[model samples]
Target: MDRIQEIVDFWFLPESDENYGKQREVWFKKNPDFDAEVRGKFLEDFEKAEAGELLHWSESARGSLALILLFDQFTRNMFRDSPRAFAADGKAREIARHMLSCGFYDELNTVEKQFAALPFEHSEDMDDQKLSVKLFEELGSGEALDYAQRHLEIIERFGRFPHRNEQLGRESTKEEEAFLKTPNSSF
Candidate 1:
């Protein structure tokens, strides 16, 4: 029910009036396979953000934002994929950066509760850790794997991964998997 989750939900839910699918068809052509609880939480967040309730962006947002921008740039240079999906808007990025600098994530959890109280159109896409890992890999820093593992462990520990994905899958490039299997490769 966080603000970011809300934004993510509003942008993807087929039934949502604010669905971003029409504007970004390729990003969301097929419906995501998320459960009702997850979808509800995301919608909860989206409603709060839309209501003008300020969210404290994560401390990791600057790093996250930078990586996404870099990945877009790298892909443009290397493979010429879709014209950069990262926001080029300096104002928005700056606002996000400032939020990251000013607030703690724990504080944001309270804000998320307020968001969850509101009703909103349902949405279903909550593979947040998977997306994080993908973003990390695209940045080519290998930190994505670390970030993914942290989230995956939480899901496993909480027994949520099975409900989320029968596979409870985590992305791994062939090279990365090989590296993990190799002995004494910790860096």
Candidate 2:
């Protein structure tokens, strides 16, 4: 398999397996320096995307940049030992691609069209249970839950991915924690 596929499969298998973390650990041990560099770059890109600079260029660019940001986040989480295996499932990729394709056609629609429009700010803060809920509603509960669970794993692995800065999230570990506690939680 190609390096990308190998990496993708390694990072995203399924949450039910105990071997996922072990396999990821072994891979990280085999490539420590490269992993660190990748993690750093991922963090940098993540921070940039979180700041919303990457999303302001164009609709398609914003969506594509979001995918890259998410991809890096998952890969970085893998190196850190969290190994969210469920991400490899095709549903998440399909939804992301669909979102990007929709973004490509966004210009064809009028400002008042109100189709699948994304928020103006493309920061990590913009990604939350609400977004997950919307995606889930658009897709299905299964894929949405899978994505949420994987996202939670990513945040837990980093000790701080996103949704941590909310005043309500200050004392919580899981993004879902604060989210669930909120009256606005759709899950």
Q: Which candidate is the best by TM-score?
A: 2
Question: Candidate 2 on 1-187: residue-level lDDT in tens?
Answer: 4332333333433336655323234332436675665565455544454455545422453344344433433443433444332232232234344554666533322211111222211113324434544544544346434655555444444444334334223454565575556552321
Instruction: Give the least accurate 10-residue stretch of model 2, judged by summed lDDT.
Output: 111-120
Question: Per-residue alpha-carbon lDDT of model 1 for 95-121, expressed as tens digits?
Answer: 333433555212333222112111110
RMSD to native, candidate 2: 12.4
For candidate 1, give the lDDT: 0.32
List ranges where model 1 is wrong by over 4 Å: 1-31, 54-95, 103-187
The lDDT of each candidate is 0.32, 0.39
The number of clashing residue pairs in each candidate reads: 1, 3
**Cα-based lDDT at residue 40, candidate 2:** 54
Model 2 Cα shift for residue 85 (angstroms)? 18
